[model samples]
Target: MNAWIGTLIALCALALSAATAYVQHRARKRETLGADVTAYFHRTSDFARIKLFDGTVRQAGYHLVIWNHGPAPAERVHLAVADVEGAAVELADCPPDEFPLQRLDKGARYPVPWIPVSDTHRGARRFTVHLRWQDGNGTQERLLPMRRGQTNV
Candidate 1:
């Protein structure tokens, strides 16, 4: 093979390797986190307190629950929450590494609350909550309607 051609091939190989690594890293990162919940059961807290804003700035705050239904312990759990209606709503990003919800103790429930800080929470009709956990195991999510009225929270 020509010297120049060999060099070109080597460069292409390097680029391919880099791309592969990046893809793998992202896949692993996603796996460590279980799934995203943008449906039901988001307004209620473990204590049965519901956190919601009455179209005011305070409404930007939201409370959610995280339950561990798996038998094995999860290492790190990250939750990304967003308001469905509010464009660019800021969701809480949590990396619970070395602090997975082991306390749930198999089929136990854990409630977590998050506040929207950015303008992305304006006029939000629905919300999307993403839960990422460690080693990519024990990842699940739930999506619930936004409830108004007297919430326990």
Candidate 2:
């Protein structure tokens, strides 16, 4: 084979190896993230009438739940809340992993306050909940719609 042709083949092989490594790295990261994350709820309380407390901006404040679904306990399960459009807002963070439900089973539920900072969203015709989190491997996000409340007025 010509020297130039041999060198070209070697360069192509190197490029392929680099690409494969990068892809593997990304997959590993995702797996790690999925392991640590738990399930989150759009609303904490069940579909029952309850008094709404004053929240930060104008919407009624209620406690939302984030359940740990991992087989083993997870610490520092990073969390973030956002609007339907993916705009993030400040939320209370708990370093200590607390499982409201007993045993922290796969489907167990935990309470986390997800106060809608925007009052206008209170009577919102429709809204969504965006959950962002990461455990150790990588990061994952969950989007769920906030259940609408009935209005007498």
Candidate 3:
């Protein structure tokens, strides 16, 4: 009887430990995805074309993929050009009709168009965009440095 009681006690302790570990794992996953966001610069896959009527002023086209990989959704997401350098790009290009997204659910992807005012597009493409959004905490902002291909946008 004593041995059986000891075995039962050990099993109960093991079960409790497993339950605690499972709960902790779930919490860790939730913490990891608190509110993360990223953007990727899509170069040519978009097949965006631009033809300029004026010889002096030219343009090139590209797109960006903004993604929210967080567990919670981001609201009122807005993107705007912050700065441009080493490139002859348009500074006041109007944003897409979807200026401020109503809501970007978790793990959602959004695409935005980019048309630079340069045809050759030589030299470095150092442009920065400011991103703003609202989440559980409050308003959040990020600066996205543009690059050529699938770089860290």
Q: For model 2, how does the per-residue alpha-carbon lDDT over 43-122 read when each residue is reduced to its tens digit?
A: 42343333333322222235566665654334444445555555654433322343222233334556655444455444
Off by over 4 Å in 3: 1-33, 49-61, 85-97, 117-124, 149-153
lDDT of 2: 0.50
Candidate structures ordered by TM-score, highest first: 3, 2, 1
Residue 91, candidate 3: Cα error in Å is 8.0
Error of 3 at 13 (Å): 21
Estimate TM-scores for all models.
Answer: 0.38, 0.40, 0.56
Better-scoring candidate (lDDT), 1 or 2: 2
Query: Which pairs, if any, clash in model 2?
Result: 32-137, 33-138, 64-112
lDDT (Cα, tens digit) per residue for candidate 3, span 1-153: 999999999999999999999999988876654556667776754355443334334233456677898888888887665336533244223435656888889999886656544444433356776778887767888887877653222
Best by lDDT: 3
Model 1, range 1-153, lDDT digits (tens) per residue? 699999999999999999999999987776545333222345533433333444433432345556666554444554455555534345333333523443334455555544545555533445665555543444444433454233433
Error of 2 at 2 (Å): 45
lDDT of 2 at 69: 69
Better of 2 and 3 by TM-score: 3
Quote the positional error of residue 136 for candidate 3 in Å.
1.1
**lDDT (Cα atoms) of all candidates against the true structure:** 0.49, 0.50, 0.66
